[model samples]
Target chain A: MHRRRFVTLCGGSVAMLAAGLRGVRAEPFVDFPKVRLVDAAGAPLKAAALATNDAYVFHYPLRSFPCFLINLRKPAGEPREMTSEALAYTWPGAVGTQKNIVSYSAVCTHELSYPSKEGSEIRYAAEASPLSGKPGMIVCCAHDSIFDPAAGAPRLHGEARDPLLPVRLEYDPAEDAIYATGLAGTWLLDRFLKSYRRQLIAEYGAGVYKEPVGATSAAVLLNTYSGGAVSTC
Target chain B: MSECINRRDFLKMGGAAVVGGAAVTAGCASAGPAAVSAGFKAALPRAKGPRLVIVGGGTSGLTIAKHAKKEYPKFDIVLVEKRDMYSSCFSSNLWYAGLINLEFLADHSFLDAARNNHYIYFNATATGLDRAGRKLITSEGEIDYDFLVVAPGISYDYNRIGVKDEDTIDALRTGYPGGFISPTEHVTIRRKVQEFEGGLFLQYVPNGNYRCLPGPYERACMIASHIKKNKLKGKVLVLDANPEITIKKDGFHAAFKELYNGIVEYKPGSAITGVDLAKKTVKTEFDSYRFEDASIYPGVRASTLIEHLGLMDAKSPQKEALISQLKYNYIGDERVYVTGDSRPHPYSKSANTANTEGRYVAKVLAARAQGKDITWYSPRTVCYSMVNANPPEAISVDAGYVLNKEGTAVGGFSPDTKLFEKRDAAKGRGTLEWARGMYRAMFEG
Candidate 1:
C-alpha cells in the first residue's frame, strides 16, 4: 500500500507532510494528462505504429523533446517484464493484453540530450553499443548516457545523475492509441507549477495567486522561475 | 531579455550602416584637434604616467583595458579598435537557431565601457608597428605605448580555397557568407538560412584548426532542427575538408544520426577546391554538387595586424604569430604582447581563453608598473555546444593549462586541471549560465 504525501520544495528549502491514508495511491505530480504525445505532424501517437525497438520523440508540457514511447514486443523474442518501479500507470491486460509496451521521458537525466531524436541516431537500446546488453536501455547520444526502460529508465551509465522520468501510459484499445495520463516525477511538475504561477501573477495580480493547497512554498517557486541566475555561492 | 533589448536596440537601428567589412574599418579617422583624455571627448589635463596601448578591442583587449584601469589608477590605457561595435561569433550558433537575435550578438559601444572605466577609447586601426620606436602607426598619427597588447582575432584566407582574385573572393563572400567571426557576415548567414526554401543547403568546413572546432557541426544541427521543426522539405549537406570530425566526435556523430537522420547528410574528406558562382555549384576533390545556398568557412590565420607586425616566421607553412606562453609577448619583443586568437598556442582559440589571458596580462602589467615580480599564470578555456534546438540543452569541453618545464603553457596535469570532455545534462543547463556569467563578468563586472 503506497501512501500519498505532499512534498514541498523551494530554492533551498524542503518540507513534506503525509495525508491520512485510506488505500489511496500517489497522484501524478507531473502535468502529462493534458499533453498529447504526437508525431512529427502533430497527430496523436498510435501504439500499432511502433515496431519492436522503435520509438518516437515529442515535446511535452514544459520543454520541447520531453517524452518518448517504445514498443518492447519483439518478433521472435520472449516477452520481458517491466523492471522499473517508477511506472505510475500501465496499460491493462484487457486492453489487448498490452503489458510489454512502455513510455519514458526522452530528456536524458545526465545532460538532457533529448536522445529521442536530438541526441542519437539509434532507435532503441538493443541497437546502441555497450548498452545493448540490457533489454530496455535507451542511450543519450550526447554523453553516452544510458537508461533501462524496463526498470523505470534508470541511469545505466554516463554522467546523468538521475533516471529518465517515467510518464504514465494509458492505452485506448478502441483507437489503438496511447495517451500519457501522468508522470512519476516532480521535475517537470515543479517547473510547470512555477512557470504557471509566474504567468498567473503577471496576468492577474500577486494577490490572486492565493497559495493553493498542496502547492510548493513561494520561495521554492521563486527559485524555480528565477532562470538559475541567483547564485547561492 | 529586457536589458538585452535595451542595449541591442540601437545596434539594430544604426550599427549596420556604420561599418562594412573588417578591412574597410581597419583604417583610422582624423585625429581631432584636442588632446582628449581617456573618454575621447575633449582636451583634459595631461598627467605624467606610463601609457598602455591595446590593439583590437575584442574580448581580450576590452578585458585588459577594463581590468588595468581598475587595478592601476595611474597608468594611461588606450584601446585602439577599428570598429565602434563588436559582434561576437562565440554564441552565434544560437542566433542561427533563432534562439537569439543577431542584434544581441553585437556590442554597439566599447566607448561606453571605456568611458565608465576611464580608459582612452580610440576609434582607429593600428596600421604599422614601429617596435624599435615603441610606437603604433595609424591613419591619424603615431601613438606611443609603454606596454602594448594585441588581441586582433583572425582573418580568413580565401586563397587557400582557390579564391585568388578579389572579384571571386567578394562574390563568394556576398553569395555564400561564412559566418565565422564578424557581425555583418553572421547576419548574412542568418538571413540566408532563414530565407532558405526547402532545397539543398550546403555547408563547407575547413581542414585545419579553425576558430571554433565544433562550430560547423553545431550549425548543421541547428539548421537541420529548424528544417525538421518547420517541416521544410530540404536536406542539409555537410562537406568536411578533413577526413573526419576534428573535435567532439561522439556527440556530433550521434546528433547527426539521431536528431537529423534523413534531413542531414555528412560527407567527410570532401575538400572544396573551388565554387562556380553562376550555377551555385561547389567543386571538391571528390565531386561537384549544386547548392541552393551555402556557408563556406575558409582557412583562417592571425589577423592582418600580425602580418603587418611581421610576427610570423617565414619558414612555417601555416602562418601564425609566435608568442611566449607566460608573457604572451611577441617572440622578439617582451614589451609587445599578442594574446587571443592572433597568437599561436596549444590552447584552443576561444573567447574564454582570450578573456582569461586578458585579465592575466592586465595583472602582469600592473605588477610591472609597480616594479613588482610577476609570475606565470595558466589560462583556462571552456566551450559549450548546444545539441537540442527547442530545449537548448548543451554539451561542453572544459580545459585548463599549466606551465611546462620550458615555461610554455600546455594542457594541465592534475585531475582538477585536466580536460573534461564528457557531456552532462547538468552541464547542458550550465551552458547558458556559463555564457551569461561570462558575458556579465566581462561587460558588467
Candidate 2:
C-alpha cells in the first residue's frame, strides 16, 4: 500500500494528519489571511489569471517557495476523484468555485531551478495517461527532470530523488481569495523564511503583516500533500 | 547585543579583542551615525596568530573574514571597505522595480557584521598596496598583514565608450549612473525610475563578463514591470552591446513580449559607442538614440587596485588581472590572494561564486597556516531572473564549474545558460532566498 493511501484510509483528511503531526513541530505555520495567493505585482492570485493547463507563478516576499497555480478544473475525459483537502490545496484555478485549481512548488529538489519559469508548460492527461503522467506534469530543461503535480508532484524523470514540493492552499468562498496554508517538501525554504522575516522586521518593522507558516516535519509535509487525501493502506 | 554597542563601541571592542586581555575598553566617542564616517584609528593592537587583511568588505572579503574568524578565532582578521554602508549588486533590481525597498538593498552597518565576528573593521578607503612589505596603505594609515586578500570588485572603462575628459565622465557618473554593483549607483537608478514622468528611458547593457550576468535583463524587466503596473507613459529602451541576449535569452525575451509587450523596446547589437551628456543621449554604430534619463553601463575590468599591485600578467587583457586556477593567489605573489570579480579565473563574476570562493579561500588559508593540504574544490553559481511582474514568473541558471587538468575552469552552461519560466515566480522567490542565504553566509554566518 502507498504511504499516502494507507494514511488516507486511517485519517479522514490529510490536513488532519498533517495538523496533528506538524502543529507541535512546525516553524510558524501559515493559515488563512496570513498567506494569500499573490501575482507578480503583489495582487491577489485569481482564477482568471490562468486557463486550462496554464500556470500562474505566485510567491510572497520572505518565502522562497517557487509555487505555481494551475487550473485542473476539467481533466481530459473522466474527472479524477480527489479529496476536498487535496482539492483545496491544489485543484481548479478559482477559490470556492471548485475550478479544480491546484498549486505546486516549482523548486526542483535536484538543483532548485523552477522549470515553469523558463517557458516550460505543464503536461495533461493523454489518451492513455501513465500513472506518473496522470494528474499534471512539470519538466525541467536543464536535466529533463519530470514531476507529476496531480499525483503529489512525484518525480517521473531526471535525477530528482524526491517528488516536487506541494503548496497547500485554502479557498475563501465569499472573497474568492486563495490563501496558502502550508507546504510539503524539501527543507530548502526554512532558511529563506528566516532571512525574509529578518528583513521585514528590519525595514518595515514588526507591525507589517506578512507571515508564512512553515512546516517543520518533512514526513508530515510529504504525507499531507501526498496521494489526494489520506487512505489506510 | 550590547548595551553601549555603537560604531565607536564596535571599534573599541575590535581593538581590545585584538590585544586579547581580561578587559576590553576604549575611549568614548559620540554616538552619531557618522562616528565611523570619519574612519577608525589606524593603530590596531597586534594579533597572536597570522594577520589576514581583506580589501573591499563586500561578499568575498567579508566571507573570508567571517569564516576565518569563526573557524580559528586566534587568527587576526581585518576588513577594509571604502563605503560605510553596502548596497548589494546581487538583487538591487528588486529595488528598482519596487519589489523591495531601498532599505532592503542598503546595508548601513556591515561593520556590525565584522564586529559580531570579532574581526577588526576599518572604515577607510584603500589607496595602495605594498606587496613586498605585506602592508595595505589606506586613507587612515598603513596596516601590515601576513596574508592579504584583494576582492575590491570591478570598475568600468568610461574611456572605452568615448566618455573621455573628466567633465564627460563626471556628467555620465551623476546623470546616467550604471547601477551595476554599487549601492549609491542603485539609489541613482531608483531615483531616476521614481522621477520618470514619461519620455524615453535608456539602459545600455555592456559586453563581456560584467558583475552579474542577468542583472541588466532583470533590471529591464523590473523597470518594464514598474512602467506597466504604474501605467507610466513611454517605454524602456534596452540597448544591448551584445548581438543577442547574453544569458537567459528565452526567458527575458518571453518576458519582454508577453509581460511588458510594447513597453520594453529591446535592440541587440546596439552597443553604446558614445554618450552626449548635454543632450542626454547615447550613440551606437548604426544609430543614435535620445533619452530623458539613462543608465549607460560600459565594459567592466578588474579594480585599478589589482593593476596597481602589479598582479596582472603582461599577456593578460588590460581589463582583468589573471589569477591561478587551483589557488586564487596571483601568479606573481602567493601571499597576496585575489578572488571575486577582480580575478581573471574563467568563472562567472557573480556574488554566488564570490561567496563560495571566499569561504573556500578561508579554508585553504587555515590549512596552509597549520601546514596541511586541502583539495582544490571548484566554485558554483546560481543566478535567478524575474521576467514578469503580474504573472510573477522567474527563470534561473545554476552553473557547476570544474577545473580541467590544463588549469582552466569549464562550465558547460556558460553565457549559454538554462532557464525556468513556468515556475518563474518560484524562482523569483528563490532569488530572494539565495541572495539572503549567500549574504548571510558571507557576513553574518
Candidate 3:
C-alpha cells in the first residue's frame, strides 16, 4: 500500500493525481468532478439495486462520453493494472459491499464504437456470447473484441490490444448511492471526441458534448438506452 | 539515323507509343513502359527520418502509412497512390441495392487521411522500381525510400476466361466490367443495375483464391434484391467457378432460397470457358448461357505492378509477389515488400484482412528499422456479408489464421475461428459498423 495524492486543477473541474498502487505504474490521472448516478426519473441509483444480469449506461465526466455500470453478481477480483494505447492505470476494483460493482467506458478501445440512442455495437453479455463464449463479458461486435469487466476489463480475445478504459466509482453506504469520480485512460476521451466530432455535434449541441456533467448524471439500462438494439456478439 | 537516337530519346519514344496505345497495350506487358522520370525527386519535404514509401494507397498501403508512423515515430512515410479520389471496393455491392449510396463508398478522402495521420499522400502512378537504388519510380517522379511496400491489389486475367484478343478484352472491360477493381466499374455496375429491364444478369465468380471470395455472391443478392423490390422480370445468375459457394455458403444459400428464391439463381462449377461478346453469351465446358447484362469477372492475378516491379513469384498461380508469407518482405530484399492482394498468401483478399495485415507489416518494418525483430502473429479477418438489403440482414465470419504443421506459412483458419452463418438484422447493423470501423482505423488518427 502507498499514499495516493490528488492535486486539484482547472478550478476543481479536473484534477491531476499520482496513482500509487502495488502493480499499477505512476501516471497522471484526469479527475473529473464527482457526479452522483441517478436513475431516469432523477432518483439516486442504489448500488445494490442494480441488476446483475444486464449493464447500465450513464454519461459521466462529459455529456457525450458513455460508461457502463455493471454488477458482476459475484465479488470482483483484486485491483489490477490495466494498459491501453492511451495510458496505463489501476482499476481500483469494484466498490459495493459485496465488491461486485464495476464500470468501464462504453467505447471500444479497438476503434471507439460506443452506445448511441439508436444502437450500440458494444454490449454487456450476461450469458455466454457466441463471440466471447463466456458469461459476464463485454463484447464489441464491431470487431469481436471481448473484455472481462470483472477482472479490470482486460481484453480476452479479438483484435483489440488494450483493456477497456476503467471508470472510477465511489459507493456511499449511508445513502446506498454510487458516484463516478474520475476516469482512467482519459487520453482515449480526447480521441473519441476528435474522431466523432460530427456525430457528437449532432447528438449533443455543437460543443455541449464536451461539457462536464456537473453534479448528477442520469443512468439508464443498456437495453432502454440503446432502444433494445444492442448487439449480443 | 536510328543509331543516333540515344537511350533517353528512344525511351521517350517508347513512352509516347505506350501512351498512344494505352487501351490496346494495357495488360499485355508484364511491366509498364520504362520509368521515364521527370528527372527530379518528388515534390515532397525533406525526410526528417528514415523514409518509408508505400505504393498503392488502398486499404493495405493506407493502413501501413498511418500505423508505421505510430509504431516507429522516427520513420517518415509517404503513400503513392494513383487515384486522387478514394472509393473503397469492399462495400461497393451495398450501393447496387441502395442499402448505401456512392458517398458511403467514395466520401473518404486521401488528403484528409494523410493529413490526419501525418503522412504525405503523393498522387502518382507507380511505373517501375529501382530496388538496388532504393527508388520507387512513379509517373510524377522517383521517391527515395529506406522501406517500400507495394500493395497494388489484384488485376483481372482476361486470358483465364479465354478472351485473348485485345478487342474482346476491351469490349468486356468497358461493356461488362468486373466491379471488383475500379470505382468506374462500380459506377457502371450500379448504373446497369438501376437500368436493368429484365432477363438474366450474370455475375461471374472466378476460380482460385480470388479477391473477396464472397463478393460475387453478395452482389448477386444485392442485384436480386433490387430486382425483387422493383418486381422486375429478371434473375441474377451467379456463375461460380468453384464447386460451391466459397464462404458463408449457408447464409448466402439461405438468402438465395428464402429471400430471393425466384430472382436469384446460383450455378456452381460454372467456370467461364469463353466469352462471345457479340452474342452476349458465356461458355462453360458443357453449356453456353446468354445474359442480358453481366459483370464478367475473369480469373484474378496479383496486380500487374508486382510483375512490373519484378517482385512476382513465377511459381505462384495467381502471379503474386515473391515475399515471405509471414513477414511480407521480398524474398531477398528487406528494403522492399508487398502486401494486400499482391502477396502470395492464402488469406482472404478482403479489406479487413489487408487492414489487419498492414498493421502487422508496420510492426515488422518498425522492428527491422531498429535492428530488432518481432515474432509473427496472425492477422484476424472479420468479414461481414450482406445477404438481404430489403430489411438489411447479414452473416459474418471472425477468422484468424495459423501457420501449418511445419510452421512455415499461413495454412488454415485457427481453431477459434467462428462463422455466424445465421443471417440476422444485428449482424446487418454490425456490417455497416464494421466497415465504419475499418474506415476509422485507416483514415483517422
Candidate 4:
C-alpha cells in the first residue's frame, strides 16, 4: 500500500540531483505524467486480468521507449537498493492486491537492444531457457544477458553490468487498474535515444520519438507486439 | 625543418637488433642523429589532463579510447589510426553471401566516436615508440603521453605455408588474398565469389593460433552458398591445416552435409607446403590441388608493428607483445600496454574478445592513473557463424577464459562456456544484431 513512498523516503530525489550536478550526460531519474495502462481497445486494463506467463510491452515516458509489465505468479520481493554506472536508487516493490505485479525497461543496459517490431533480442521466458536455465528470467539473445525480474531485475549473468531500469507502477484497488508513473536509470534512456536517433526519427517522424507519451499508453503482449519474432535464447 | 624517419627506415636500422636481442638496442640505434632533429609534434590541442595515447583504431583501441574517458574523465585520450576510413574485419564473410553490405561494416565514423566520447581521433600511422622518453613516434609527428596502449592486431606469416621467398609471397598475396585483414582483401574476395563460374574455389585455413578460427570455415559456407544459389558446377574446397575444424565444428559439418552437400569439400590436416603461382596449384604435405580462384590464408602473428616497435617477445612463436598477461602492461614498465589480437593469450582472436578486454584494460589504466590497482578478470568471446544464407541459419559460441594453476596467464575456456552448435533462424537473426551491438559499443557513447 505504501510502496511508492519508499522511493522518496530513500532520498532518491536528492541522489538524482547530486548525479545531475556531476555533469553526467543524463539524469538518474525522470518523472512523467501518470499514464493509465490501457488495452488495445483503449480501455483501462485490470491488474488481476494480466497474464502471468509472459511480459506485456508498453511505451512509457517517451514514445520510442519500451517497458515490460509482468505478473510474478507470486508476491514480489521487498524494496532494495541498487546501483548502476548512472546512479544509485531504491527499487520500489511490486504493487497490487497480491503484490505480484512489476515492470522494467525492456532496453538492455549492455548496448540498448530492445524489443522491436522486426524482432526482439530481449524476451521473458516463462519456462527455462538454454541461456538462463531458469524460468521467470528476462533473456537478451544478442549478447546472452539475463535478468531476474521478480528480484528487482538484477543482472543474473552475461555481459550486462547493470540491472534493467525500473519502471515505477501504481495500482488503484478501487478501479482495479494499473498506471505507470516514473522511471529509474534514465541515463540508459538518454543513451538509447542518442544512439538510435536516426532509426527512431525514421520510425516516429523527426522529434516525435522523444515526445512524452500522453495521458494513456497501450500495453500489448510481447508475442503480439513483436509479431512472434522473439528469440528463445 | 624537422627530419622525418618513416617505419621502413626505422625497421631497416633495427633489422639486426631483432636477432641480436634486447629491444633497448633498437631504441639506441634510432636515438642517433635523427632523434635530435625530429622536432615535429602532432598538431593536437594540449592534453587537459593525464594524456592517454592509443595506437590502432580496431575494436580494442576504439573501445579503450571511449571507455577510458568514461572510467576516468581526467584522462585526455588520443586514438591514432593509419586509415582515414573505418571497416571491420569481423562479420566480413556476410558480405560475400549478400547477408550484409559494406556500409554495415564500414559506416561507423572514428571522428564521430571521438566527438561523442570527448577524445581526439588523429589519423596517423605509428612508426616507433620511445618508452623511456614517453613519446609515440608517428608519421605526422610525435605525441607525448603519460600512458600508451598498442593494439595493432595481427599479420599473416607466409612462411608457415612454406612460401618464404619474397617474390612467391607477393604473388600469393595479390593472386589469392586472405579476406581476413584489410578491406581491399574483402572486396577482392567478394568479387571472386560473385564472378565464380564453375570450377574449384579454394579457401585455405592456416595452422597455429590464427585469427578468427571460425573465419575460414564460415567463408567456405558463404562461397558454397553462392555456388549453390547460381547452380554453378564449382565446389568450395576447404583446405584446413588442422586435424579438424577449429571451432563450432558440428554446425559447420552439418551445413556442409545438409545445405551445401556437393558444393563444399572439406580436407583436414592438409598443411600447405608450397604454392606454385604459375600453375595455380597448392602443395600440401601429402597432396597438391589446383583452383580457379583462391583466398590463401596464411598463419597469423602479432601485427608487424609489434616487432618493428621493439615490443615483440623474443621467444614468442607468434611474435606477440612481451607484456604481463594479467595487467597487459609491458614487463617492468607500467606506462605502456599491449592488447587485442596482438596479446599472447590463447583467447579467441575475435572482435568480442577485444571489445571486452579493452574495457578491462581501460579500467586498469584508470586505476593505475589514480595510483591504485585491481584484480584481473577474463574476457568473453562470443562468435557467430552463418551456416546457411537462403533462409539465414547460424550457430554461435560464448566463451570466457580462466587463469592457469599458477594464477599467472590465461589457461583455457572457462566452465561456463556454452556452444549453440544447433544452427537455427533465431540465431541467424541474432548474428546480425550481435554485430550491430558490437558496433554500437565501440563507436557510440
Candidate 5:
C-alpha cells in the first residue's frame, strides 16, 4: 500500500496525518487578515503587482523555489492552485503578535529541499509539521520535522533536527498582501530529500540510471528553470 | 590592424613593463568604488601597512588580494607563489587544440600587477598552514597575515596508479593534454606529438573526481583534429571511467560522429589497468592493446593539506563510515579562505570556476575590509568548448545561486548571439584575452 494511503486506512484524518508527518499544514497554520489592497511595494516591490506579475508566473524559479507571494486585495479568492515555481509563503514580517501566522520550511539544515506548500504554509507533504504550535503545518511529509516560523528555526516537534529554510517576505499595505523579498539560500526541504531519493530509486532502480544532484546540475537549475520534476517514490 | 598594433605595442612595451609598470597602476586605479567619490578614495587601503598574506597566488589568491586591497588599501597585500610566473588554465584549450602558442597565451608574472598595487609578491611554496596562528609557513620563511586567502589550484595523484617518479610521469605528460597549473611543460608535449607514428594514442582517464571534467574531451578533440589535419592513419582511443563523455557532451558527440569520421574512438565505461611502458602496450579490463604513446589522466583527490586540516569528512579504517562532525562553511574561518581548484566543490574543476571562485572569495574578503559582516556565496562557471574549430557549445552553472537547487546555461551552438554568447572570442585572440582577463580580474582592477 502507498505509505500515505496505508496511514490513512489506519483511521487518521488529513490533519492527524499532517501531525504525524512534518512540513505539511492542515489549517490554522497561516493567518490572513481581512484587509485587502490592490498592490503594495513595501519590500521594494508592489505586493499586488507581484501576485499577478507574469514574471512571477514563470520566472519565479529564479527565486529558486516553488515560492510565491500574493496580494490580498487582488487575490481572486478563487483558491488559486499555484502552478508557479515559487512555493508561495506569507510576507516576511510579524505585524505585532502575528509572527506565527506565516509558515516556512522544516527541512534539515544539513541538506536543502524544494518542498512545495500544502496549505497556507509550504510543507514537504511527505514530511509534515507546523512551524509553531499551529497544526497542519508540515516541515516535511517525508520527515515529520517542525520549525518555529516566528523565530525562524525549528520547533520541538517535527524535523526539529532541521530548521525552517526561511524565505524573506515583505508586506505591501498598498496591496494588502506580501511579496517574496529574499531567500535564505538554503530554505530547501532538507527532510523530503529522502522521499525524492526513494522515488528516483524506485523509478530508476535498474541501478543503471545515474542522476547526480545538488551541485553542478543544481548549479544548472539555478541558472534557469526546467519544467520537469522527478517524483519521490 | 589596430588590434595588431595594440598587441605589438603591448609586447614591445612588455620590456618597458619591468620599468614602467602600468598594469599595476591600472589595477590600483579601479580600486575605489565609483559610487562614493572622495571619502571612498581616501579610505582605500594605502598600499602599505598591515600584512595581507595570500597563499596560492593563483586566480583566487591573487584576485582576493587585489580586491581586498581595493576596499582597504591601508592594508598591505602580499601574494605568495611557488612558481616563477602565473599562467591560466582556463581557455588553455587553445593550447591543446593547437589553436594558440603556449608561450604567448599561457605566460604572465604577477610582478607587473603586484607593482601596480604596490603589493608585495613572494616567490615561495607554502609548506604548511597554522590556521590557529594565522601564519603560512613557506619555503622562504613564515609569513603572518591579518587575513589570508588560499587557492592552491589542483594537485594530481599520478603515483597512486603506478606512474611513479617524475621521469615516468614526465615521459607520460609528453603531448597528452598535460595537467593544468605550471603549464610550461607543453614544450615537451609538442615533441611527443611529432615522435608518434601510426599507433593508438590513448587518454586513460583515471577516477571520476578530477580538475576539469571536460578536459579529457577537449584534449581528445584537439588531438583528433590535429591527427586529421596531418592525415594520420593511427587511431586515438579515449578510455573513460565515466559512463559518458562530459563537458559540452552533446556537441562533442555530434562533432565526433561527423568530423572525426573514425579517427577518434571514444571508449566510455573503459579504463586502463596495467601498462608495459617498455613494450609500449596497455591493457584495459575490457581489452588489451598496444599504443605508441599514452596519456594516463589519473584520478584527483583532495590535497594532503586539506585532509591534514580536517576539512574533509572523517573516515574509518575500513572506510566504512564517516565521523559525524560539522564542516566549515565559507572556507574555514573569516581569516582564511580557499577557492579555485584547491577546495572540493560540486562544479567541474575548470579554470572559469577557479576564476569565479577567486572573485567570490575576494568579494567576501572585500566586505570584511569595510567593517561589514560578510555573507559568502559559492562560485559559478560556464564552460565553452569549441570542438575542433566549430562554433563552441557551453555548459553554465552557478553554485549556491538558487534558493533550493541549481540550473544550467542554455547550451548547443547557434548563429544567433543569444545562446552560447561567450563563443564570440576573436579567432586568434581568445587565449591571450582569457589570460589577460583572468589577470585583470584577479590581479588588476
Candidate 6:
C-alpha cells in the first residue's frame, strides 16, 4: 500500500466510530483502493482525472511546457487502474488539426521528464526549437529553453537534442477520453533560437542601451536581470 | 515591463522573456530619472584574458575544474558559484538520520584544488553564454571561456508540480522540494519534519524521467526509519510518479516492510497532477487527497544552465551529453565537458555515477592534454538505493565503453531488477566508504 492510501484507510477507520452515530464525510483523506498497478495490456491508469472535459485546457496563460492539461468529458467515480495499451481517442475525433488523433510525447527533447509548468506557463523541459518533423515550440523559461513547434527538435538546446517521442494515443468512443498505447519515436523540428533572438530585438529595439529609458526597456525584456523595472511611458 | 513596471523590473522581465522565447513587451513604466547602482557596476572584475568560468560549485563543475586546471595551467579558470558551503547530497540521508552533521558534509573551496593553478572564483550568477566568442556573460563582467562546462545541479519545476510560483519556493515549509537546492530550504524542511507528529507524510512523485530515479524511495526509507525510530503515529505515503518505480520493487518492499511495517504506505502508478498549498491537499488523476506535510517532486528537465546553452538531445540516452559537431553539438568546444548530476546522463542520478563521470571526463581531458589517443576511461555509474532504512541497495550499469558503440563514453541505467543487489554486510559499509571518498575527491581540494 502506498503510504497515502494507508493513511487514508487508517484515517477512514479512525473516523469510523464517529460515522456510526451520525453520517459524516471522512476527513477527505487519500483513498487508494488496491487496484492493479497496470492493465492487461500493461499500461498505467489515471490516478486522478478532472470531472469535466473543459478542464483539459488550463486557464493560466503563463503555464510552461511539459505541464499537462487534464480534461475528461466524463470520469469514473474513483481512480482506477489503467493499462498502457488503453485506447485514447478514436481517429476522427482526436484529430483537432488533422484527420486522425495522434499521440503526443510530453517528454521534453532535453531530459525525458515532463516539462515543468512554471507560473502557470508550462516551460518545455527541453528547448522548443523545431528539429525536423515535430510541430510546436515548448520553451523552457529558465535557460536557453526553446522548442520549435513546426519541427520538434529532438534536442531543444544544450545537450540532448532528440525528437520528442510521440505517445500512441487514441480517442475513446465511450468516454471521449484520449488513451495512450505505446511510446512513439519523436519527430524532428527546426531550432528555436531564430524566433527567440528575434523577440528580444523586436521588443527592446535599438533604444535599449540608453540611460534610464534604455535600461528600463531592456529590463522589461529581461526580468531576471532587469530587476522588474517599470517602464516610463 | 509595462506601464505598471519599473526599470529594474523591466530588465528582470526582459531577461525572463528572452529566456522564455516569448515576444517580450520590453515596455517600461515611466519611472523618472532612475540612477543605476554604481556599486553594482563597480563590483565587476577588472581582468582580461582567455577566461574560463564555471557556475556551479557542486560535484560536476568542481570536479571538472580540478582536471581542467591540470590541463591548462596558464588559462584563467574563473569559478562563479552561488553557495558558500557545499554538502554532499549523496550522503545527505545520514544527516536526516542524525548520523552526520552539516560540518562533516560541508564542501571545500576550489582555491585548494587550484593551488598554483591561477583561477578567479566569484560568487555570482552567469546570465548568458555567447558560444561563438567562448564568453560567459554574468551580472558582473563577461568572462571568456575557451571551454565552458556547466553543472548547476537540479533546479525544480515547483510551479509545474503545483507549488504555485517561484516566490512560493520560499513559502513552502515542508517536503522534499524544501532543501533539495540551497541549505536554507533544507533547514526549513528539517523543521517541518521535526514539528510533524503523525498522519501521513505524503511525498508525491511526478510523471516520467526525473532527477535521481530512486530518490523518492530513498527519502521514503529515511523518513520511515525516522518515524519508526521516533515512534510517530503517522505512516508515509509514497505516491509514485508512475506504476512500480525505477528501483527494484521486491527489495524496496522488503526493506520498508521489515523496518517500517505500519509506518510506511506505498502507492504505485499514481501521478500527482496538482497541489493545494493552503488546504495541504494533493490532487491526483484519481482522487483528491489531503496531507499534513506534502512534499511534491514535480516533473524535471535539464538544469536552467543546460537549457540556456541549448544542448538537449532527445534521441540520445544522454540528454545532457554533447553529441559531435556532425550533429552540430556543443561538445568539445574548446574541449568543453559537462559531468555529474547536472548532465542528463541515462544512468540513475546518483552521486556514485556523478563521481564516476567526473573522473571519466577528467581522464578524457587529461589524456587529451597529454596528447594521447585516449579512450580507456568510459563513463560508468553505480547507485546505492535505500530500500527501507538499512544502508542502501546497490544498482550498477554502464554505457559507451561497454553498453553502447561509437568511440565515445557516457552514463547509463537499466530496467533490469537484478542490476540492483541487496547489499551484504561488508558491501554496505563499502558503499559508505566509497561515498566518503567521492566527496573528498571532489570537495576536499
User: How high is the CA lDDT of each candidate model?
Assistant: 0.59, 0.60, 0.83, 0.84, 0.44, 0.44
Evaluate model 3: give its lDDT: 0.83
Model 6, range B99-129, lDDT digits (tens) per residue?
Answer: 4567656644556544423456677766666
For model 4, what TM-score is found for chain B? 0.92
Q: Which window of 10 residues has the lowest lDDT sum in candidate 2 chain B?
A: B21-30
Highest-scoring model, DockQ: 3
If both were scored by lDDT, which would come out higher, candidate 3 or candidate 4?
4
Q: What is the DockQ of each candidate?
A: 0.02, 0.03, 0.35, 0.34, 0.01, 0.01
- In terms of lDDT, the poorest run of 10 residues in model 4 chain B is B24-33
Per-residue lDDT for B322 in model 4? 77
A1-233 in candidate 3: lDDT tens per residue? Answer: 01112212322222221111112234545677789999999999998789888899999888889999998968999998766654577779999899999999999989889999989999999998888877999999999999999999999998887788888999999999999998874656766877898889988889788777768999899999999888867
Weakest 10 consecutive residues of candidate 5 chain B by summed lDDT: B317-326
Q: After superposing candidate 6, which stretches have Cα over 4 Å from the reference?
A: A1-233, B1-51, B71-76, B116-120, B159-178, B309-337, B366-373, B386-420, B423-428
Put the candidates in lDDT order, highest first.
Answer: 4, 3, 2, 1, 5, 6
Residue B315 Cα positional deviation in candidate 4, in Å, after optimal superposition: 0.7
Compute each candidate's TM-score over C-alphas.
Answer: 0.60, 0.63, 0.91, 0.91, 0.52, 0.53
lDDT of 6 by residue, A84-201 (tens): 1111121111222222322233433432323211111122212112211122334332112244322322334322334333333344444444443323211111111111223334
Please list all clashing residue pairs in model 3, or write none if there are none: none
Give me the displacement of residue B227 in model 6, in angstroms. 1.1
Candidate 2 per-residue C-alpha lDDT over A1-233 given as tens digits, one digit per residue, 9 for 90 to 100: 24344223323332333222212122222222236665444555555444553445555322334466666645322222222211222222223465466666655554454322223222233222221233455654333356665555556654455555556667776667677665542243432333344644664567342333222111111112222211100
Which model is ahead, 4 or 5, in terms of TM-score? 4
lDDT of candidate model 2 versus the reference? 0.60
Candidate 4's C-alpha runs over 4 A off are: A1-29, B1-37
